[model samples]
Structure formats: C-alpha cells, structure tokens
Target chain A: MTELEKYIHGYFGVPTDDLAKIVTFFKPVSLKKGEYFLKAGQLSDRLGFVQSGIVREYVEANDKEVTKWISTKGYFVVDLASFVFHQPARWNFQAFTDAELYVIDQKNYQRIGQMVDRWHELEKLFIAKCFTVLEERVLTHLSMTAEERYQQLFAFNKELFNQVPLQYLASMLGMTPETLSRLRKKSF
Target chain B: MTELEKYIHGYFGVPTDDLAKIVTFFKPVSLKKGEYFLKAGQLSDRLGFVQSGIVREYVEANDKEVTKWISTKGYFVVDLASFVFHQPARWNFQAFTDAELYVIDQKNYQRIGQMVDRWHELEKLFIAKCFTVLEERVLTHLSMTAEERYQQLFAFNKELFNQVPLQYLASMLGMTPETLSRLRKKSF
Candidate 1:
C-alpha cells in the first residue's frame, strides 16, 4: 500500500472497500519549492496530505512571520479554520521544497460521507486526533522553557533542524533564532 | 427548556427525540465554590456543561499555576485530552463559584452513539468547534501583544474582571499579574 493508503487505513481503520473508495478522491499534485498551496485571506477549499518534502504554515503578524507548523511526509496540511468554517485563511501554506501531495477538495471531502458507511465516525476520529495534537502544542508552549521546547522538538524530529530554516523552527518553538542557536550548540 | 437543553439543541442540532434521549444521560451536578470537578493526575471520566457559575482549568508548571481557561455558564468543562484519550489529567478544574452542571460520564458519552443515529456527525462538529477555538487562542498568543491580549479578553467578557481573581485572568492571558494590573489601570 502507498504511504497515504497506509496512513488512512491505520488512522481511520476503514474496511478495504471503503478505504479504496476514499483514496480515489485524492489526486496527486506537485509544487515547486516556495510555491504556495494556499495564501492568507483566501478561503481554503482544499486539503493536502504530504507525500514528500515539506510544507510550511505561517502567518504574518506585526510585520513578522510566525511559523505555526511544518508538514512533512505523512502529515496533512490545511488552514483548518478556513477549510471547516469557510473563513478567510489566516495562515499561508507554502512548499518549503519541491513536493508531492495527495490533494482533496471540499466537494470530494463532503462526498466521502455518502461513499462510506462509517465516514462520520472516521472523520470524527480524524478531527479528534488533530485536536489532541494541537492541545499538546499549546501545553508545551505555555509550560515549557525555550530550551526545553528545543530539546523536545529535537528529540521528536531532529531532521526538521536540517531541512527547514533555523528561523522558522525558532518561531514555531516560540523562541528567537538566537536562543534556538544557543540551545543547538549546547545540545550538539 | 433548560439552558443545557437549549445548548445541546443549538450546537448539535439533534432531532427532538434524539436530543431528549441524549439529554437523559446528563445528570445535574453541583460544586461548591473552590470545589474541584477534576484534578491533575486523575483520569477525567466525566464532562460537564456549566449551567451557572465559573470553573477554572489550570496547570502547575515550573512551580507556577498557569490558568488555561475560565469556563462560565453555557460552557463545557473537562480536561478534554484526559476525557477523550483516558490520559491522566494535566489541569485542575475547580469551581470559582458555586456551580451547577449537566454532566455525562464516559460510559454514557460512549452510549450516545448507539442511542442517536447522527451522534458521530454531531460529535465531530463539537470537536471541530473546540479545535477552532483553540486555534484562535494559539494565534492570538503568537500574534498579539500582551496589551492586545488584555484588551481582547476584556472586551469579550467584561464581567470576568470582577468575577475572578486578577491573577488567574493574567495567567490565562499569558501575562504576568503585574502586567495585567498595569494594563487594567490604563484601560480603566
């Protein structure tokens, strides 16, 4: 099975027939490095699951860009608020490297419910997982020291340090780039 | 109809029969001022919808108590991660005032699926709403200044200033109590 199929099957636990049908809606799409998948203020009508490379989600605030997340292989990317609520997007999602993704638009996303008998259950679980991940980030940000945050991220995804710009990782960890550099030197 | 009933009807949009059946599982419960609904390290087995009064969700981190939220009437209170994933609770949920709630235990929460055909759909929307709210909080914290955060919260819930300890509000907004005090004097 493809990584996307494996992820869908593992996470959602859909029966083979249902899983096959669900996967059909997602078409393969490519992006050049620095190309935007979605931009701020536009409605996010589609969602992407990264097949390869990285996508960065960031927002411009007070003339500074704050990195919200970096989506890598096997991770889904979207401005969830805009995708779910039809709000203008607040974050810009751009490819950090030439990338491939399994893309699904809103219409097909809705059609999955009609196609799969347990779509609602699967979708609910999917969103709950997202919520849980976000809650963890909030708790870490509120409670952890900058060095602790750097250490935790290093332990979790050390490759991220090499792949993304240090400044983006610093912003995502809610620290200045200089602070992240200091921690990196100490850890290394 | 009670406030809890109205909330269930409005947020979930279950049909009358299903709504009545769903509401049956939630029993009325009360907490005295300073009483705890759930405490850190315990598993959160119950979820409560506040009918009146305030409940604070806070964590002790780095020897300091960080208030995550202060839920009031019509709001739901639970360590959502613990409640959903059966993890040890990280936050203490205590009544800031004598409070009444409509609560459902985990068992009853699970049984709602068998009782209501559209339970999955409603539950998905419920979680999606929670995710969106948290996303907003994360954005505000990342993008807004301490003063801006103070102004936003004050505008949204003016009564909270008089109702709870200023320190708790300060902690929740991620500002020091002294900073909050200074901002209050300026705003007033």
Candidate 2:
C-alpha cells in the first residue's frame, strides 16, 4: 500500500471496499518550496494529504509569523476549520520544501455520501480523530513546561530538528527559539 | 420533544427513528451544586447532555483551578477526548448549579452503530461542530486581546456574568479575575 493509504488504514481502518472508494477522490498534486496551498482570507476548498516533503501552517501575528503546525509525510494539511465549516481561512498553508500531495476538492468531498452509506461513519471517525489530536495538542501546551514540549517533540520527530527552522518549531511549541536552544544544549 | 431532544434535533437533525433510538440510551440523571460528573485522571465512560442548569470543566494548575469551559442547557458535557478515545480525563466535570442531565454510557454509545448506519454520519457532523467551536476558541485566545475576550463573553452569555463566578469565567477566557472585573466596569 502507498504511504497515504497505509496512514489512512492505520488511522481510520475503513473496510476494503470503502477504502477503494475513498482513495479515488484524491488527485495527485505538487507544490514548490514556499508556495501556499491555502492563503489567509480565502475559503479552503481543498484538503491535501502529504505523501512527501514539508508544509507549515502559520498566521501573521504582531508583525511576526506564528507557526501553528508543521507537517511532513502521512499528515493531512488543511485549514481544517475553514475547509470543514466554509469559514474564511485563518492560516497560510505553505510548502516548506518541494512536496507531493494527494488532494480532495470540496465538491468531490461532498459527493462521498452519495457513493457510500458508511461514509458518514468513516468520516465521523476521521473528524473525531482530528478532535482527539487537537485536544492532546491543547493539553500539552497548557500542561507541559516548554522544556518538556521540546523534549517530547525531539523524541518524536528528531529529523525535524535539522530539516525545519528552529524558530518555527519554537513558535509552534509556544516558546522562544533561545529557550529551545538552551534546552537542547542541556539535553546534549 | 424535550430540551435535550430539541438540542439533538437542532444540532444533528437525525431522522425521527434514529433520534428515538439514540435517546433511548440516555438515562436521566441529576447532580446538586458542586457535584462532579467526572474528575481528572478518571476514564470518562459516559457523555451527558445538559437539560437544565450549568456545568464547568476545569483543571488544577499552579495551585489554582483553571476553568476550561462552561456548558449551559443544550450543551453536551464531557471530557470529549477522554470520552472518545478512552484516555484519562484531564478536566474535572462539575455542576455549577443543580443540573438535570441525560447521559449515555460508552456501551450504549457503541450500540448506536448496530442500530443505525447513518449514526456515524450524523455523529461526524456533531464532532465537526465541536472541532469548529474549539477552533474558534483557540483563534480568539491567540488573536484577541484579554479585554476583547471578556467583552465577547459578556455579550454572548450575559447571564453567565451573574450565574457563574467571575473567576471561573475569567480563567476560561485566559485572564485574571481582576482583568475581567476591570473590563466589566469599563463596559458598564
């Protein structure tokens, strides 16, 4: 199975027939480094799954960019609230490197229910997983010390340390780059 | 239809048969003021719909209580992540006033699938609504000023100003009670 397919199975565990039906909607797409998949003020009409490369979600704040998240392979990259609810997009979703994505447009997304009765069930589980992940992220930010966040991130995705800018990671962790560096040195 | 039934219809608009089936699992329960529905570190085994009165979700932080959310009549009250994923709950769910609730345990919640195929679809929409609400809250906290947060809360739920303690609301809004009080005086 493809990485995207594997990730979907692992996360959603849809039946074989449903998985086949779902994968047909995802169209192949590519992005050059720094090109935005979705920009602020636009309605997000599509959601993409990262097959390869890096992408970042960020907002302009106090004359600086606040990174909301950075995604690599096996992640869905979208201004999810905007895509799901038809709201004006809040974050700019830009490729941090040349990237390959499998994207589903809004029209096809809506048409899924027409194809399968279990679509809602699968989709509900999909959205519930998203909610759970966000809940964990919110909990971590609220309850964990900055150093603990740094340690947790480092342990989970050590490749990000070299591949992505330190400042973006720091901002996403709700801390300064200097603090992350200090923690890194102490750990080393 | 009862208030909880009305809320379920307003929010999900499930078919009459499915709605009736869904409601059967929810047993009526009540709590006096200061009674806990669920506390931190416990597994959240059930979800409750508020028929009347108020509920608060909070966590102990820095030797103080930090209010995460307050739910009134028409709201579903649970540590959502814990309820969905079987994780240890991080928030304490308690009554802010004497409350009447309609609750469904995990077993009954799982039984919905066997009862209706469309339950997942309706449930997915229900969860997506929860995610959208959380997204809005996160955006407000990240982008809005403390005074703006207080003003918005007061404007939306002015009754909460009297019904709930200012400190709880203040913490929920990510502010100090003093700041909330100052904003209230300025607005008055």
Candidate 3:
C-alpha cells in the first residue's frame, strides 16, 4: 500500500474497496524547501496530505509572522476556511523542507459523494477528527501554562527542535523565544 | 416552519425532500435553566440545535470553572470531541436559561445516510461550516486584542452582556474579570 493509503486506513479505516476508489482522487506532487503550497490572499484550491518532509502554516500580524503550526508527515495541510468557503486565504502554507504530498483538487474533493455510498459518514468522521484536534488545542491553550505547552510539543516531536527554527515553535506555543530558551535550559 | 427548520434551510439549503428526511433525526427537547445537556467526563451522545435561549460550555481547572463559550439561539451545542469521537467530553454543557432545543442522538445522526443519498454532501457542508467557525475563533483569539474581542462580541450580541455573567465572558475572552472590567470601563 502507498503511504497515502496507509494514512487513510490508519486515520479513518475506510473499507478496502472504498479506499481503492477514494485514493484515485489524490494526485502526487512535490515542493522544494521554502516553496509555498499556498499563500495568504490567494483562494485555496487543493488539500494536500504530507507524504514526507515539513510544511509550516503561519499568518502575518502587525508586520510579524505568527506560526500556526509546522506539520510533518501523516498530516493534511490546507487553509480549511479558504478551501471550503472559497474565501481568500488567511494563512500561508509553505514547505519548510523539500516535501512530497498527495493533493486532492477542489473538483475531485466535491466528487467524493458520487463515488461512495457512505461518503457522508466518512466525511463526517474526517471532519470530527479535525474538530477534536482543534478542540484539544483550544483546551491546552486555555488550561496549560506556557511551560507545559512547550514541554508537551517537545515530547511529541523532539526532532522539531533540531530541524525547525525555534522562533516558529515559540510563536506556535504562544510564547516568546526568550521564554522558550529559558524553558529549554531549565529542562536540561 | 419552526426556527430549527428555518436555520437548516438557510444554512445548508438541502432540498425540500432531503430537508424533511434530515429533520426526522432531530427530536424536540427542552431544558430548564441550569440543567446540563452534557457534563465533563461523560460521553457526548447527542448533538443539539438551539431554537431559543442560552447554553454555556465550560471546563474545571484547579477548582475554577473557565467558560469556553455561550451559545445562543440558532446555534448547535455539544462537546464536539466527544460527540464525534466517542471520547470523554472535555467541557460541560448547560442551559443558562430555559431552553428549547432540537436534539439528534448519535444513532439517528448516523442514520441520515440510509435516509438520503445526498446526505454526505449536506453533512460535509455542515461540518465545513463548523470548522470555518472554529477557524475564525482561533484567528480572532490569536490576532485580535482582548479589548477588540470584547468589542466584537458586544457588537454581535449586546444582550449577552446583560444576560450572562461577566466573569464567564471574561474567561471565554481569555482575560481576568478585572482586566475585562477595566476594558469595559475604558470602552464606556
């Protein structure tokens, strides 16, 4: 099975025949390091699942870039509002490293219903997963201290510290680089 | 048409026949003020659409309750993570006032597919709307000042200021009651 198939099965466990049909909607694509899958102000046209490498999502606020997330393999990346509503994108999606992705265009995404009988159930399950992830983020931000947030992310992906810029992680964690540096030292 | 039907039509624009079929899944339910729709640590077994009145969602932390949101008329209420994933609910949902609601248990919610062939499309549109709303909230929290958030909410629903306790609003806005008070005074 392809990595994309593996991800879909692991994430949603769609039946094998249905999985075979669903996989056809996605087309493989790649980006060099620092290239963008999407930029702010453009309408999002596709949703990409990361097969390898890193993608950074961020937004500009008062002349400063605020990192929303740095997604690695086994993640889907898109400015969801833009993709669904056809609104101008608010977040920039860029490759932090040379990345391989499986992309589904807007047209094919809309065609999922025609291809499968239980597509709504699948879509609801997919979206519910997204909502749960967002809910957890909100909970963590509201309940956890900055130190706890930093520690949780570090524990989840230690490689992020070595591979990506600390400033980006700091912004994503809603802390300053100085505070993150202090926490890093304290952890040691 | 009832307020709930009007909302479903206005929001999703599902066909007349499909709308009738979809509405069957929801059964009318009412709650007295201060009654919980779902409590923390319980499984969220149903999703509710409010026809009227207010519902407050909150979480307990360090012996303090932090308000997450105050849902008013024409809004859907649930612990989203629990409803979708069958996970333990993270927030407690309670009626802040005598509330008229239309609720769909998970079994009925999942049964929509057998009722309508296009149910997936309608459901996807519905979920995409939820995701976009969540995205907007995240953007507002990250980008807007606390005072700006207060002003925005006040402008959108001034009645909430008088009907709900200020401390719950303060918690939802991620500010101390003292800070919220200061901002309110400054605004006036």
Worst 10 residues of 1 chain B by lDDT: B136-145
| DockQ of candidate 3 (2 decimals) | 0.55
Could you tell which candidate, 1 or 2, scores higher by lDDT?
Answer: 1
Top lDDT hit: 1
Off by over 4 Å in 1: A185-188
Clashing residue pairs, backbone N/CA/C < 3 A, model 2: none
Off by over 4 Å in 3: none
Interface DockQ of each model: 0.59, 0.41, 0.55
Per-residue lDDT of A45 in model 2: 95
What is candidate 2's lDDT per residue for A60-119, written digit by digit as tens?
Answer: 977777787899998988887688779898889999999999999999988877876666
Candidate 1 lDDT, tens digit per residue, A1-188?
A: 77888998987889887878889899999999999999999999998999999999999988999888899998888887788789998889999999999999999999998889878888788888888788777777666778998889989998998999999998888778998999889987
Relative to the true interface, what fraction of contacts does candidate 1 keep? 0.52
Model 2 chain B: worst 10 consecutive residues (lDDT sum): B135-144
Check candidate 1 and list the clashing pairs.
none
What RMSD does each model have against the real structure?
2.0, 3.3, 2.1
Q: Give the count of colliding residue pairs in each prediction.
A: 0, 0, 0
Residue A132 error, candidate 3, Å:
1.3
**lDDT, candidate 3, A49-107, per-residue tens:** 99899999999987878888889999999988788889999899999999999999999
